[model samples]
Target: MGKWMRSAIQRQKQFYIQQLMQSGLVNDHERLEQWTMAELRREYERFNPAYNAEGGSRHGQTSPRTGEAHH
Candidate 1:
């Protein structure tokens, strides 16, 4: 059980690291690997355009059918 949990956590970290790299947030693999999962998630969300300042999805602000911001 412990091994499986550890593996899952590792996978999540790697996933976030890959996303950060793809988003041009981090350039060094070694440095990224040194960061904790929480740090990785924080940084990832900080750069995510869909998230508002309160960390809520911005989708609600847009009209579902038109895909335009609600005025």
Candidate 2:
């Protein structure tokens, strides 16, 4: 990758790293540094409230508490 591309990726990774750390999903910065950007993003999104806010209906599943699909 070019210098700019690498710099961008590093910045994006830093964002995810901070998010993951704040979410308590990651404790070791060294291990996080070894992760690919895609991996970091996936982990961050997994715990991100907005990413999960779409609810189960959109994902083709029913809610466990109500046994009803979200709308």
Question: Which candidate comes out best when scored by lDDT?
Answer: 1
Candidate 2: count of backbone clashes, pairs at least 3 residues apart or interchain:
0
Q: What tens-digit string does per-residue lDDT give for candidate 1 at 4-23?
A: 99999999999989997897
lDDT of 2 by residue, 29-60 (tens): 88888888887876665556777775322453
The runs of at least 3 residues in candidate 2 whose Cα sits more than 4 Å from the true structure, single-residue gaps closed, are 55-71
Report, for every candidate in turn, its global Cα lDDT versus the true structure: 0.72, 0.71
Q: Which runs of model 1 end up more than 4 angstroms from their true locations?
A: 53-71
lDDT of predicted model 2: 0.71
